[model samples]
Structure formats: C-alpha cells, structure tokens
Target: MPDSRDRKARKRDLTPEQREKRQARRREKRHASPEVRFILDNNTRVPVDLRPYSLNWDAARIGDPSYYVIGLAKGGSTLMHELVRSLCEAAGRTYIDVPAALFDQGVEPARAVLDPDWLRSRDGSVFGGFRWLHPWMDNLALHERRKIVMVRDPRDILTSLYFSHAYSHVAPETGRLADTFDEQRTQARAQSIDDYVAGPVSLRVFRNYCHLLALTRMPDFRSYRYEDVIFEKRQWIRDLAADLDIRCPEDRLDAIADAHDRQPEAEDASNHVRQVAPGDHVRKLKPETIDLLNRRFAPVLAEFGYGTAS
Candidate 1:
C-alpha cells in the first residue's frame, strides 16, 4: 500500500469523476463505522474514535480550577503563558505545561485517557497554555474553566508568522516534522512576504482567529488583543488578572510586565523575539496586500477593536 503522502499526491492527479468516486467510497466507509468523530473548529475531522470512553474522566477532581491560555501560534501566547505561570507560582498553584508532543501526535487519546490524571496530579489551582484550539478540546467542557484567548492583528500575525516559520522558530535536529519545517523555511525564503501570507498560511491564521472569537461566547472565556497586551502592559495585566481571579499586587504586576517588555534594538531573523512592535505589516507588506488582508480580516479587526480603516 502507498504511504499517506503518496496517496495524497496520487489523489491530486485524479480526474473529477475519480475524485467523486473516492469521496463516495470515503463517505461509505465513514458511515459503516460505529465510532464517533469530532469536527474541529478548523473543519478537520479527528481521526480517532471517541466512543466507549469519555474525554472528561475525573471531572470532579479537576473541577473548574484550571486556567487555560489558548490562542494563535505566534500571537503572544508564550508571553501570556509565562505571565500566567508567574501568577500560578505566586499563588502556590501547580502550573501544568502540556507537552507539544501531545498536540503533534494526537490529542484525542491523551484527552480521553491521560489529561485528567495529568491535571489532577498537580495540586491547588492548575493553569497551562495551548497554542491553538484542538478537536479534543471540544469535548473537555471549558465553560466552567477560566479560559483566555489571545488574538493579534491578522496582518501583524502574518508578518510574525513569516519570520518565525522561515527563520526564528526552532525545529528538532532531525525528524519528519523537522523535514517539513525545513521545506517550509525554504519555501518562505523563496517567496515574498506578501505571497507567503496570501498562501495557505493566511487561511490557517484566519481560522484560528475565528475559533478564538467563537470561544468568547462561552461564559468564563475572554479574549485579549495582542496590541493591548503590548501597548498597555500594566492595565492589560491588571485586567487579565482580574478576569482570571488572580489577586495580583501592583508591584508584582509591574515586575511581570517589565520582565516581558522586550524591545530588541534590531530585527534579528535568527532571534525568536524578532520584533515586538505592532503594525510591522504596514511597513513590510504592500499596499494591495494590506488592503486585501484588511478586507479579509474585517470581522476580526472590528470585533477586537482593531481599526479596519486603511
């Protein structure tokens, strides 16, 4: 049998009739299965069957004490995660850092069987961050938990993403995933930033923003804009702390804000913190590219109080 990559390549070469036939066969096979599947916010199906066991085991033990910081990959999630970790430490709470490996491999099995134990092992209030929403999270019952979703201007996010994927973001020394990242880096280097943003990367970023927006409808969920976190550091920290019910002191808030206030003297493509300034897209992207992104991201811009006006 051909590998998945080979199958995909061959599928792309199929005629319209052949594609329809393949899709019909897939539908039949899906209907034949008794296993349950979840559709993620990104419109991808979770391949794992979620039947027989619930993802929410040990719910009473876990209870609503966990805090989750979820957002776009390059959208200040690391900064927020560190700040939350600081707050957890101050309160003597356990900070559970979910391994990126779980996400990379598949969160379905972990969520169904392992997450509760992991969350329960930590004492007191537990808080951690996830890079983005995953299909398994849909079954985790977040409404009772304190969840914050961070969003950046999709334009700035694209600018940051281009640099991160092409240069700054680190990959493993060797692996299939590392090879994929290498390919992406090469492609990103070859294309203009505008072309790179206009490609599939834009869709992924926009979908993340949409998912983040959707979470705002949950009772205990809040959304924070990257611009506010950067420009109005103190006020933003206080607001975030209040939302998460953390009694952060003025001095501590100042310390946290000061610690993360990064302003690099120069744009270093090799550095993870390439540049912290907002609206880098205005200077880097073309007029037409900016206009297109502004239009495409109008809903997100308006919802997050980001001006859509050129």
Candidate 2:
C-alpha cells in the first residue's frame, strides 16, 4: 500500500545484483510460460485465464491492467496510441506502450516494456499498446480489458510500410522484425516507393497484413479503420474513451486529436504527425501491384467495407 514515490525509493535501495536477478527472473518468466504459448498456438478466445507471472511482473499488484489497441505495423497504430495516451493521462491513468516481451524476439530498447519495475509502477493506470500477434490475448485474460484493432487499406498499408522503411530509422540493420524481407530491404530502400511496392517489400506487407487479419477470427475483437482515425478523429476518440471507461470532455478530446492529427505532407518518419492521407497507394503503387493487392487482400477489404484500389 505504499505510495509510488515510496516504491521508487525502496527500489533504489536494492543492490545492483539484486536488480539484475529480478530482471533475469522476469525475462525467464516471459519466455517460459507454457500456458501463454499454448493459448497462442490454439488461438484461444474469450473467457480465458492470464498467468500470474505475466500479470504481476514485479511480484506486486500495483499496476493497472492494459486496454490494448492492436493492429498491423503501419496501420495507424501510432495515431491511435497518441490519442489513447492523451485520454489516459487526462483521466488520471498511466498509459504503457507495447512490451517487447509480448513479441517473439529481438525487441528494440526504446519500445521494450519488459522491465519488471516499470510495468509494476503503473498500478491503477491504463495499459495501452499494440500486438502484432494474436497470442497476446492470453496475457490479458487475467484483468479487466478492452481491445481495439486498427485496420487500414492493405494497399495503403504497403505504401506506408515502404515509406516508413525508406525514410525512417526502421531497417534490417536497425533490428526491425522484417526478417522475411532481409535480402531485398536494402535495395528496396534506395528504390522508389512504387518499385518497392512491386518487390519483396510488398510481399512483406502482404504477409504481415494477412497475419493480423487471421486474428479477426478470435471473438470479442473490435476494430477501427485507419481512415476513420484520420478523418473521423473526434467521434473515434469519444467512442474509444467511452469503451475504456475514461471520460473526457469533448473539447479536450478534440484538442488531443488536433494535436496528434496526421499531416498528409509529412515525409519525416520520425515526426509523429506523419502523412495522413488515405489512398496514397493509388499514387505510389503500380497497376500490377494494385491488382495483386486487390486480389490477395480481397477478403479483408471486403470484410472491412473497403473498395479495391483504383
């Protein structure tokens, strides 16, 4: 029942070896959980149980459970993350991003949330983050939670993925998870977005998209369209807030949306307010690539009420 400040002070009193031991144990628990792996393998749905080791990262029950927002990598997750964080802060709750442990391997330090101490500190706060995989649902069964899946036009997702890699810090050498495109990623970086879309990069995006779509089969999952997140920001924010039980003023919600709104002209990947346009795929994709996407992603596009590329 100690205050956060007291917890921090006490944590600081621990010996370096003790801290290292705790960290090692946390890493072990994340990797060694058979139940989590089993649920993931079976694609287990609602009314599941979350393992205590995964939930109580620090062996203390001080952190709040997460309300997750999951989606494909380039599927407007950043914008949704910004809006969610703002609402959480406004509602006096802490917001946590995706922990690297939730991923299968090779987590970048900046995005990793596996630290036992950090996860425990957000007690009574909201946990928000993206999961590229479906098995992550297992980790949430232990707490009260809601999930939001962000969907984007597959063609646009490919376009953004190309630009995100070409312009941003994400690259094979940067420890990105694009192992499938390793051979061609460097060449694709120098090539035009159009060419990238026609090459291995396109396949990478397609495979990732399909991977995420497979999770839709699981029950109790709700989704947000990337286009809705961009154009219908206010309504989306309001609805999401209601779903997560975080009440915020409409004006405040609008302000947060405006602040995080995507700039259609933003070419800077590092800039949070990146290009916000829907259908950039039309401009950047070749006719053949467009055909391929329409054919390959037809089911998802149809299910989400998205028309094929022009």
Q: Highest TM-score: which candidate?
A: 1
What is the per-residue lDDT of model 1 for residues 36-141, given as tens digits with 9 covering 90 to 100?
4434444554444322222222222323365677767788878877777676656445455543433343433223333332233222344455776654566556
What's the CA error at residue 92 for candidate 2, in Å? 1.7
Report the error of model 2 at residue 130, Å: 1.6
lDDT of each: 0.68, 0.60
| Native-to-model Cα distance after best TM-score fit, residue 35 in candidate 2, in Å | 20
For candidate 2, lDDT tens digit of each residue in 6-120? 9999899999998989976775554333232222222432121233213322332333344556666677876776687778767765454543333333333223323233333
| lDDT score, candidate 1, position 107 | 38
Query: Candidate 1: deviation at residue 229, Å?
Result: 2.1
lDDT of 2 at 181: 43
Pairs clashing in candidate 1? none
Write down the TM-score of every candidate.
0.71, 0.64
lDDT at 240 for candidate 2? 81
